[model samples]
Target: MKVELVQLAGRDGDTAHNLARALEAIAACAADTDLVVFPETHLMGFPTRDTIAALAEPLDGPTLQAIAQAARAHDIAIAIGMAERDGEHYYNTTVLMTPQGIALRYRKTHLWASDKGIFTAGDRYATALWKGVRVGMLICFDIEFPESARALGQLGAELIIVTNGNMDPYGPTHRTAIMARAMENQAFAVMVNRVGTGDDGLVFAGGSAVVDPFGNLLCEAGREACRQVMVLDFDRLQAARNDYRYLDERRLTLPGERIEHADGRRELMIPQDSF
Candidate 1:
């Protein structure tokens, strides 16, 4: 599938401008593209805890609706992160919207330091089918944790789309994390981070990139304003799996079932049967 990563400027608390820029990127990359990924909270800049709480909006609010409209018009799928308001509580949510409409929603499971008090943790990882491919979704900080990507990989996801608004401090560390997660899980991973300064003191490093199942760097962006489209060849990914049966050999045993884990950390996480 032709997967595109869009890294753009997200103005703090400016949902309107953010939505407009996101739609514009989707429209620009629509041609010959199957899915487009945006940065975490691309709608509301990654503000401080207090600002994020105030900017949180309902799932069906205008920001999400605007993204859906853009997907429909472009005839492509979109995965984006936003501050989702559910009643009195809110979550760092990532919504996967298809041309037809919203396919699935996955909240960030691993919350950052300040996010602990600001956003609700997700119950589990979720995947949605888009154009015959199993697409997994993860928000910014969620991808930093190995368990998040492994959760999706265990569920038979072929591609994991990560939307991040990663801070600038540990740029290389976070960038390596993407490849590490992808290589360990044997799934194609795509990351889209933001650029420019926001209302807060944080600076975002736009090192948005895509990696193959073997951890090969397909495409990567520097610390600059960038928007690029790269093809995630399904056949090539399958070939890698066929050549090396490592992923299929790894195993994780749950209460009522056992599964494969390319790495040996199978005993750490609880299985579905246990739950």
Candidate 2:
């Protein structure tokens, strides 16, 4: 499948501007592009305590609906992040959108720094079928945890997508993590990080990248706005398993309650560690 990574800046709490920018990028994708991905919190940019509640939208809110429409209009799928408000609680979430509506929604399970108090941690790792590909998602900080991708790998994810908002001095961190994650799971990995500055004055890093199942860097961008198209070779992905299968040959498995949805989505309810 042809995937497009959009690395652009977003104004914190400015949903109007962010939505417009996201839509324009969707409309401008190349004809054969199958999926388009944006950086973390692209919808609400990194909401502050004062603006989080006001800017955060529910899963059924207008912002996601608009994205669903764009997916249909362009005959493509989109994976973008937002500040999701769910009644009494809020989440830093990412959703995969198709013409039919939301195919997958994953809340950031690993909150970074201040996010611990800002959003509730998700308890499950999920994946959904996207045009024959078993696709899973990870938010910015989630990539730092090895178990995060392993959960999805156990669920049979062939492609792992990370929507990131990593800032200065930490761009290299994610760059290394993405490659390792792909190689460790023998799955294709892609990350799209934002550029420019946010409300907190942290400059969002823009080193978005794509790694093949063999852990080769196929495409990469620097600290500037960029858009790139990458075609995934499923044959190569399959090749990664020919010699050895990590999931099959592994000595241990994660403890979780695996759920299989009728619509082809899978989730692993991670068991909380007890003291």
Candidate 3:
């Protein structure tokens, strides 16, 4: 499938402007592209502790509705990040909208630093089927955890999209993590991060990229705001999985089981349950 990564800078506290920018980025891609991805919290930038709630919107809010309309008009699927509100709680969420309407919504499960106080953690992971390809959805820090990507891999996901708002001092770490997730899962991983500065004084690192199952970088962007399109080879992904067979080789154990070594090292065991 043809995927487009939109790397852009968002104006802090300006949802409307950010939405417009996202729409424009989508419009700039080829009409036949199957999907487009945006950075985390693309609607109002990465919110601060005090501004997160103020910018939070319902799942069916106008911002998402507008994006859905655009997806229909463009004949493509769009995945974007935003602050989601469900009654009294707010979440760092990513909504995937298809030409038909909203297909899947994934809330960030691993809260980063101040985010724990501003947004509630999501308890579940989500995946969607786009033209026969099982696409997993994750937000920002969630991809940093191997279990998050492995869970999706266990669910039969062939590709994972990470909507991130990764910022200063840790750009290299985030990029390496994205590549590692792909290599370890034997699946394709697409990471889209925002650029420029935010209200929290953090300058977002814009190294948006697409990594193949073999940990090869298909395409990547620098720190500047730009649009990147890359073709994902399903055959290559399948070939790598068939050759490496990491998923099939993984050992499973009980939920609370632990393996203790004579060297004083302990490891949590994975349950022997196959999805």
Task: Point to the candidate with the largest lDDT.
Answer: 2
TM-score of 3: 0.90
User: Which candidate number maximizes TM-score?
Assistant: 2
- What tens digits encode model 1's per-residue C-alpha lDDT throughout 71-186? 88888988988889998888888888988888878888778885787887766666667887877888877777887787777777788888888887967877899998888788
lDDT of 2 by residue, 35-78 (tens): 99999999989987778889899998999889989999999999
RMSD of 2: 1.0
Residue pairs clashing, model 2: none
TM-scores for every candidate against the unseen true structure: 0.89, 0.98, 0.90
Model 1, poorest ten-residue lDDT window?
260-269
Cα lDDT, model 3, residue 170: 85
- The candidates, ranked best first by lDDT, are 2, 3, 1
lDDT of 3 by residue, 154-232 (tens): 6667889999889888899888999999998889999999899887688899999999999888888999999898998
Query: Each prediction's Cα lDDT score?
Result: 0.79, 0.93, 0.84
Backbone clashes in model 3, listed as residue pairs: 253-270, 253-271
Q: Which scores better on TM-score, 1 or 3?
A: 3
Candidate 3, residue 1: lDDT:
95
Which candidate, 1 or 3, has the higher lDDT?
A: 3
